[model samples]
Target: MSLALDIFTVVMVVAGLFFFYAGSIGMLRFPTVESRLHALTKADNLSVGFIALGVMPQMAEATDALKLLLAWALILFSSAAASQLIAIAARRNRRRDP
Candidate 1:
């Protein structure tokens, strides 16, 4: 069972890595700030969550897993707020431009 869990963790980590790469490429290739922020926040949040999940099974104690999850949740919330702020600012800039 533990071996299976380890394999699952590996797969999840690899998937998260792919998303991380995609986010980077998206930020570089996307033409608009909103699109880039969308790409950045969505992919990054998933990447961190997946990484935390991957590490959860390996933790020695239940509290460690809980801590990891809490950290991911906090990051998710903060990133969402930050994305909203960035989008609002971008929209304001667009409105100001002729």
Candidate 2:
């Protein structure tokens, strides 16, 4: 049972890493600021959630798991808010350029 949980945790962490890497590449390859923001925000949320999930099972105490999840939630909310602000600024800039 412990071995299975370890494997699951490892897999989640690896998947999260992959998502982060993909988001980085997307930022470089995407043509528009909006697209890059989309990729970054989506991947950011997924990666953080995955990492938190991985940590939850490994934590020995319930409070530790809850704290990890709470941190992730805070980060996710902030990232989403920041992304919206950035997107609005980008849109405004585009409008002014033309």
Clashes of each: 0, 0
What TM-score does each of the candidates earn?
0.93, 0.94
Model 1: residue 70 alpha-carbon error in angstroms: 0.5
Q: Residue-wise lDDT of candidate 2 within 14-98, one digit each (tens)?
A: 9999999989898889999989999998997899899899878999999999999999999999999999999999899989996
Candidate 2 contains a number of clashing pairs equal to 0
Q: Write candidate 1's Cα lDDT for 1-98 as tens digits.
A: 99999998998899889899999999999999999998999999999989899989999999999999999999999999999999998899899993
Candidate 2: stretches off by over 4 Å: none
* Clash pairs, model 2 backbone: none
Q: Can you list the residue pairs that collide in candidate 1?
A: none
